[model samples]
Target: MSVIGVVASATGGVEQLREGLVRPLLDREHQVAITVTPTAAAWIAPAERWELERITGLPVRSQPRRPGEARPHPPIDLFVAAPASANTVAKLALGIGDNQALSVLSEGLGSTPMVVFPKVNAAHARHPAWAGHLDTLREAGVVLVEWELLEPRTEAKRELPWDRVLAAVDGLADQFFQGRLRDRGAGVADGGDG
Candidate 1:
């Protein structure tokens, strides 16, 4: 079974995003695991979890961990961090898996596809380190979905386009499956028993 792991920061519309994506996956009978970061849990309530359970029929699990706890590897076929915070982005890039979210990424088995959806303001996203980190991930074959086209004014509210975001999610899933299949082939060749 294909496992799609969705991880999000405690930002606006995170639950809505998760709900939206999970619905389609459920309709198609795909396995979806919704993992919330520590920051995400602070804002999401029990009511929200109940709502998600109703909508997706999938139990929502939070990866509550501090800076040093080891993360559990759930055989993640594809890992996605949406509305990704700048702090989390930096931590992932620098190999600083201090929290559950970052820690899970580190513990992900080799050849597991990873996607990062950055939701920071345009200015923050343009930082040298951020840009470099993104480039590094790309070179390492990690898919990055950045909202650079949106221009946030000084007093403007940042809003992500759901349509575009969903489309990006679909694209990431495609890439992830391709990578996983290639890796499976490699594994088989290393020790073929067939």
Candidate 2:
């Protein structure tokens, strides 16, 4: 099973993260670890955080570990940033690791498979740098869930397009494992005994 590291930022639909992303991932038998932006940590209730911990069986991190502290979550095979705010996307594109969430995403940029769903609005997209930020991430091989796929936000709450995000994750993880398996097979074919 792949270890999926979910990073949530302070966005409108972040409250639904457990239901929309985490729980479904667990149901699919993937181990899940969560890290939230500082603002997001505050946005989620303490009781909710406890529930997340109980279900995932891992601590939900929002802050960096101290000098001697061992890492809390296991090494991640894939990363998902669902409900990623515009600010988070900008920081990630600029390689800014101001907080734990951004730090993880920043480090995983090109090496680890990542799927980011930027929960943004029209105004945010109109920003001149927005296109450039997306280009940078795409160049790094990050699978971006297009904004058009998300339902338009209204006075009444709307759910984020978690299905699309998860689909991207599933596809990327499959490709990653297949590539690894192919490499191993190639090694064996070349008479490298393991």
Candidate 3:
């Protein structure tokens, strides 16, 4: 099964991450490894954190490992950053890895396929640099789920479109694997051992 790295920031829908995204991915037979921003780590309730660990069978990392320590998670095939806060999105665009979550994402920026859902309000979108940040990420091959697609939320029901995000991930993973297979086939056709 493919291992998916889930990077989350402190956003409105973060509290539902375990139920909305992780569990669903697990049910789909994907191994999930999660890393969260420092603030998000603090914001998540203890019981929820424990449940995340229990369900994923992996540690929920928020800080960098000490020097010379073995990496805890397996190599990730893809990344999903749901409920990505405006602050985190901007920092990612700038290649700033001030925290563990950003560090993992920064290293995977170009090489790995990623799906990002910007959980921002109109005020945040109105920032002068917001568009530029999104453009930069897009140019780097990040698939963005535009905030407009997740509209019409009632004040009491602030939920995210986790299913849509998962669909994007599935689509991208298919494309990535198909491209690799085609490349391998081409090499084999040319009599080169693949």
Candidate 4:
């Protein structure tokens, strides 16, 4: 079984969690696990996990982990942090492994291909702190699927293209499961030819 790990922080969209991510992963019947930040638990309701359990028919594990410890797994095929919040994005980019999500990333990053779906505000995305982090993550072999494109005209997050996001996930799965991502000479777009 190809193990896939999904990480999310407190400040992003739940639709990213429900529809954009879990639905696509489960539709393929891949073994999936999720780790959420404490801030995210505070932001979402209990019923949300129940709904995920029903929709994905997979256990939604959200217990916070001790700082610096990665989740135990036999072998992970891919690790993706969708709707990655600015706070978490900066943390992961800097190699700070203080939580399960970050620790999982730190440990599992090179063992298999990983991706980060950044979903910060346009202002935050351009902030030097975050931009530098994005660069660092890219150099560290993390595939960045997308980020906020421009400043928000209103104080609300807009809907992202779920189909494209799923396509990216599917692309990553193909690369890792097919052993092409570790080839070191292939371009990122090699997997985008869908």
**Candidate 3 per-residue C-alpha lDDT over 1-194 given as tens digits, one digit per residue, 9 for 90 to 100:** 88999999998899999988999999989999999999999999999999999999999999999999999999999999998999999999999999999999999999999999998877778789999999999999999987463333544555698988989999998998789899999999999998
Per-residue error for 27 in candidate 1, Å, reads 2.9
Q: Write model 4 residue lDDT over 89-149, tens digit each, in one string.
A: 8888777878766777777755667888777667887676776888888888888877446
Better of 1 and 2 by lDDT: 2
lDDT of 1 by residue, 103-146 (tens): 77766623567777776767777677778977777776677776
Q: List the candidate 4 regions with Cα displacement exceeding 4 Å.
A: 54-58, 64-74, 152-157, 180-194
Model 3 TM-score, all chains together: 0.92
Scored against the true structure, residue 98 in model 4 reaches a CA lDDT of 80
User: 1-194, model 2: which lDDT tens digit per residue?
Assistant: 88999999998988999999999999999999999999999999999999999999999999999999999999999999988999999999999999999999999999999999998887788889999999999999999997453334543567788898989989998999899889999989999862
Off by over 4 Å in 3: 149-156
Ranking by lDDT: 2, 3, 4, 1
For candidate 1, what is the TM-score? Answer: 0.75
| Backbone clashes in model 2, listed as residue pairs | none
TM-score per prediction, in order, is: 0.75, 0.94, 0.92, 0.78
lDDT to native, each model: 0.68, 0.93, 0.92, 0.72
Candidate number of the best lDDT:
2
